[model samples]
Target: MATDLRVSLTDRCNLRCTYCMPEAGLQWLAKPDLLTDDEVVRLVRIAVTQLGVTEVRFTGGEPLLRPGLPGVLERCAALRPRPRISLTTNGIGLHRTAKTLRTAGLDRVNVSLDTLRPEVFRTLTRRDRHRDVLEGLAAAHAAGLTPVKVNTVLMPGLNADEAPELLAWALDLGYQLRFIEQMPLDAQHGWRREELVTAEDILRRLGERFTLTPEGSARRGSAPAERWLVDGGPGTVGVIASVTRPFCRACDRTRLTADGQVRNCLFAREETDLRTALRSGEPDEALADLWRAAMWGKKASPDLDAPAFVQPDRPMSAIGG
Candidate 1:
C-alpha cells in the first residue's frame, strides 16, 4: 500500500512507434547519462529498504533493449519486502527471452498490442512485428507469468474499430486486456485532442455484443484501469479512462527515469535527479534524501483533470508509462 517503484532499464527501443517517438529519428541518451545495471539494482534495493516500497516494475522505451535484464531482475527479486516485480515491453525482444526472464524472477508482463490486423499493427506501431508480439504473449503465458496483460492504447480513428475484436481475442487467449484512453503524453505530439474517445463509448459498444459485470478489484495504488469481467471470457478486461474519469485522487506510484531522476507526476514540469547522489559514494544518507524528496513530492496526481488538459514536456517513452 506504500509507494511503488518504477525503474526504467533503458531509453532505447526497437520500434519507432509514432505515438512515442518521431519517425525522423531518435537521439539516444548518452550511456553515461543512464543508470548502469548495478546502479539500477542498487537503487531498487535502497527503495525497498528505505522507502517502504512493496512493488517494483521495470519499464522503458523498451526495457528488454537493456543488456543483462535478467540479471537486474534477479537482484530486484531479492528485496526483503519481496516486491511484485513486473515488466512492460512492446515484446519485440521477448520472443525467445521471455522464459529466461521468468526464470530470472519476473512476476508478470504487460505487452502493448494495439491492433490485431497485420497492416494496421505495422501502421500504428511503425513496425511489422505483430507476429512477434503474439509469440511473446504465448511465451509469457508458458512461463507462468500470472494474468498476462495486453495494454491497448485506444485511438479513435485508428484502432477503435478493432476494440471488440481485440477484446474477444484476449478473452479467447485468457489474457487480461486493458484499453487505455489516449492522453497527451507523446514527446512528438501530433495527437489530435478532438480524437478523444471516452471509456463509456468503448464499453457501451462492447456491452451491446456481450455482457459485462463490474468485478471488485484493488482500488488502491495507482488504479489505472477500472476493473470489470466479461460474462463468458476466460479472463477479465480493464478500461483506463484517465481522460474521462481521472483516478488521480488515488495515485500512489512515483516514476524513476533511467537517468535516476524521480518524477513525482509524469505530467509535472519538474523532476529531481538522483543519479548524482547515488554516485556520490554517500550511499546511505544520500539515498534517504532522494527517497524523502520523492515521497513528499508524491501527489494524488497532476491537475490535468479535463479533456482540455495539455501535457507538459515529458515524452511517454521517457516517462515509462
Candidate 2:
C-alpha cells in the first residue's frame, strides 16, 4: 500500500544546482498545465480518504516558488485524520515563508544544503544564496519545524571532506543532517559509481569526530535515511546511501507531479496520467482505483546496480527530488 505521496507543486526552480539542472535554457511548465490549488487538494483528499495515505510531502523544482502553497497546506490539514504535511525545499525562500507555512499546519521540513563554505556552495549551485539558506535554517527552527533536516549530497571530490564539519554544524544548531549518496539524476548524466561517496566512508569520517552508534532496525518503515546517534547525545546524523545500499524493498511512497501524473517510483520510466482522468469527470472512487492499480504494478525494485542501468529522461528537479 502507498502510504505516502510526494506532490510536486511546480517545476520552476530559482537555483541551478549542478545535480538538478543546468544554469540556463530550462523550459518551465505553463501556468494552465499545472494543477490548481483545488485540484491538488482533491487528489490529496482521495489519496488520504481512499488509499490510506498518512503522509503527504510537498516537493518541487522549488515548492516555495508556488504562490498558493500555504493555502494548499491549510486544505490538506482540514482532511479527516489529517495527514502529516512536510516540505522538501532548497531553503532559499524559507526565511520569508517558514513561519507562515508552519502556521498553516506544515508539520516539518527538509532543506537541501550541500556545503557550508561560501565558495563551494557557489560552485555547486551556481548561486550565492548560502547566507540565505543559513537564515532559512534559523527561521525554520524558530517556526517550530521540528527535525529540520539538512540534506547534503556528497560528491566525490566536492564537499565530501566536509562531512564531519557539516554534521558538527548541524548538531551545534540542533538540526538533523543527512549525507545523501549521489544518484544518477543529474542533468548532465555524468554520474559514475566510482565517484560516489559511500555511507561507510561517511560514517568512518564522522566517527573520527564523534562517538557514533547505529540505530539499527529502529528506523521507521519506508523511511529513506538510516540514522546514527551522535556521541550518545540528543542529536543524530543520517546517510541516505541510495546508490550503495538500495532501500526499495520497503518503499511505500508514490509521487504526483504538478502536471498530475502518478509515479510509483522515483526512477520509474512510465507514469500514469491522472490529471486527464481527474479533468474528464471521473468519479473520486474511480480515480482512487486508478491510483491503487498504478502502484500495485510497481516493480519490486529499481535496478540501479545493473550494468545496463540507464538514467531517466527527467532530471531530479523535474522528478520532484
Candidate 3:
C-alpha cells in the first residue's frame, strides 16, 4: 500500500509561474469548500492511524500561503506513529516561517527555483521575488531543515543552459539539487514534445562541467529521482525524468487535494471525494474506506510517448504539485 500522502493545504499561491497558471490566476476555492483546520487534521489522523500513511507532504501552488500551516503541522506531529512531514513550496515566505514550521514537526523542505538569475526569475514567475526565495532557502537551512532540496525545471529557451551553474550553486550551499524534466502539467496545454528538454540533455549538459557517476538503482525503491554522485563522492544530484524515464510503476504516493479529494495519480482525471463524506459526519472508518476504494481503482500510469496520451485537465497548481 502507498504510505506517502501528499496533502494540499490550499490552492492559493503568490507567484504566477508561466508554466503553472495565467497571470490573472485561477478561480480560488471557496472558503467553505476547503477543509477546516480540524477537518484537515482529522483526515490526516485517519490516514496515518488507519490507512497506513507514514509520510505526509504538504504541497500547494505554494504551501507557505496557508495561514494555519504551523497549526496543521503541530497536530500531525501529535499523532501516534508520528509521520515524517515535509513541505513543497516556492520559498517566498519560508524565511519567516521556517523556524515555526520546524518547531511544529516539519522535517525538511523542497523549494522550486528554476533559475539563479533575478531577471530570469521575474520573467518565468512574473514576480520580482527572487531574492526573497534565496533568503527563504538560507533561513530554511539555518532552521535545521536538513537536506533542503531545490527543484529546478529546465525550460528549453530559458534556464536550460544554467543546469551546470545551478548544480554548482546547490553543491556549494549544501543543498540537494534535483532537475526535473518539464511535464505536460502546465495550465496552457501548450506543451509540445519536440520542445521538451529530455533527461539525456540535462545529464549531457552537466557532464561537461562535472563527473556524475550513477548511484545505481539498488537503493532507488519507490523514490522518483535517479541519483548520481558528484565527482564520485559524498555530494550528489538527482534528475526526475518523468517523461523520458518514468518511474510510475514504483510510485508509492496517494494525493489529497486541499478540498479533500483523493487523487490516485498526478495525471489522474478523476478524483474521489472525501469532503462530502467528511462534512456529512461520516465516521473515520467510512472515510478510510473511501480512500482505500480510490487507491484500489487507480489506473496504470499514462504513457506519455504514446499517441493516445492526454494531459490532465487540472494543472500542477490545481493538483498540488
User: What C-alpha RMSD separates each model from the true structure?
Assistant: 1.9, 1.1, 0.8
Q: Residue 158 in model 2: shift from native, Å?
A: 2.0
Give me the displacement of residue 179 in model 3, in angstroms.
0.5
Clash pairs of candidate 3? none
**lDDT string, candidate 1, 1-321, tens digits:** 246778887778888776778875667778899999988888888778887788888999899988889999998887787788999999886878988998899999999998888898888878789999999999999888867999988776788877788888998888989988877787677666577777988898778777888766553346678877688543677998887788777677778898888887767777887888888886666887866876686644554446656677778787787
Tally clashing residue pairs in candidate 2. 0
Stretches of candidate 2 off by over 4 Å are none
For 152-173, candidate 3 gives per-residue lDDT tens digits of 9999889999999999999999
Leading candidate by TM-score: 3
Give each model a TM-score.
0.94, 0.97, 0.98
lDDT of 3 at 141: 99
Question: Which pairs clash in the backbone of model 1?
Answer: none
Q: What's the candidate order when arranged by decreasing lDDT?
A: 3, 2, 1
Model 1 RMSD to the real structure? 1.9
Cα displacement (angstroms), candidate 3, residue 100, comes to 0.8
Question: How many clashes does each candidate structure show, in the order listed?
Answer: 0, 0, 0
Candidate 1 versus the native: TM-score?
A: 0.94
